[model samples]
Target: MSFEIRIARQFGERTIAAEFASKGGLTALFGPSGAGKTSVLNMVAGLLRPDTGLIAVRGTVLFDASARIDVPARQRRAGYVFQDGRLFPHMRVRDNLVYGWKLAAPVDRWMDLDEAIHFLGIGHLLDRWPRTLSGGEAQRVAIGRALLSAPRFLLMDEPLASLDRARREDIMEVIERLRDELKLPILYVSHDRDEVERLATTIVPIG
Candidate 1:
């Protein structure tokens, strides 16, 4: 899916206006901390309302101030992955991965549970708790959960920020594989230049 965002919002006294568009593949939102990167993603995900702008994915109107259209967050067909991996501590890996699939309402369910387990190479870790898994493993499960939702667009915000060098590398490799293998459109938020170089086919430099 393609994306186009033209938004303006007030951040205290400063007026922040973000404008960009990407066709497909992985697009990196590159900028310093607190540069409205996450805000853009949130707007696209229908989590935040823009002051006056247009946000669309594959010609689908997500937010249009002119038309007074604002889709709810849950209604947007976008999968969001946070830095924290936000797995349910009380749930097992299997349960955590299937949570999105079991949510209210329904659409196309692309990623199968067993297929995802094999895709992320986490079959052996399904029975383990989040605490027992390493940082990379936890992130993989998080991504898997997002994929199982069958999102048309993926919004990932610094997903590998918490991992160590080795763990980050491991997860990055998996991300690369997902990009090429799945051929899914992604709006990846990150500050790491190397990660951008390795994964992004397009770049949106937020400032």
Candidate 2:
């Protein structure tokens, strides 16, 4: 098991919660829009802390409210890919990919800069800026940036939501490769039933 999550947070009158243990591979949070799927992903990524409960990944306890444990976001080593590829507007593709890589310590780093570029097939786009890349290309670069960080697990929130049908399929194949070839643990959040069915090994409903 790569994930053990049972957390909840209050937002005024609404309370967002999630409870599930991943059975390896890619686990998805499936639900309708506005059901707090992204919030749960944020909690896992340490961008948002749950008011109460535990969040453990790969046997490492990230947050345990009962124990008064809340690991810092950088220490969590969670790779997060947002719906839109949030690349640095000022940086070229190469710089963007290496930003996280440089932040990770040598021992913590698993993938090298060249390996990530080759894996993502973005070697040719190194000189290009973020605005110059296409949607699918930008997404691939985003994944590469996250992967180069050498995270223990990945949290993807609607990674394919902004793409067209053809581009979605392209990115889906890339994700499948990450799951099958790299064997990286992923917590994916999506509202599309078909996308969840195609990408997730275990489907945990949200809302």
**Using lDDT as the measure, which candidate wins?**
2
Error of 1 at 33 (Å): 1.1
TM-score of each: 0.94, 0.98
lDDT of 2 at 207: 89
The number of clashing residue pairs in model 2 is 0
- Candidate 2 residue lDDT tens string, 1-207: 799999999999999999999877999999999999999988888889899999999999999999999998998898899898899999999999989899999998999988988888889999999999999999999999999988999989899999999999999999999999988899999999999999999999998
Give the per-residue lDDT digits (tens) of candidate 1, residues 50-150.
89999888789889999999999987878888889889999999988988877734658877888999888889988889888888889999998898877
Q: For residue 133, what is the lDDT in candidate 2?
A: 94
Whole-model lDDT per candidate: 0.87, 0.93
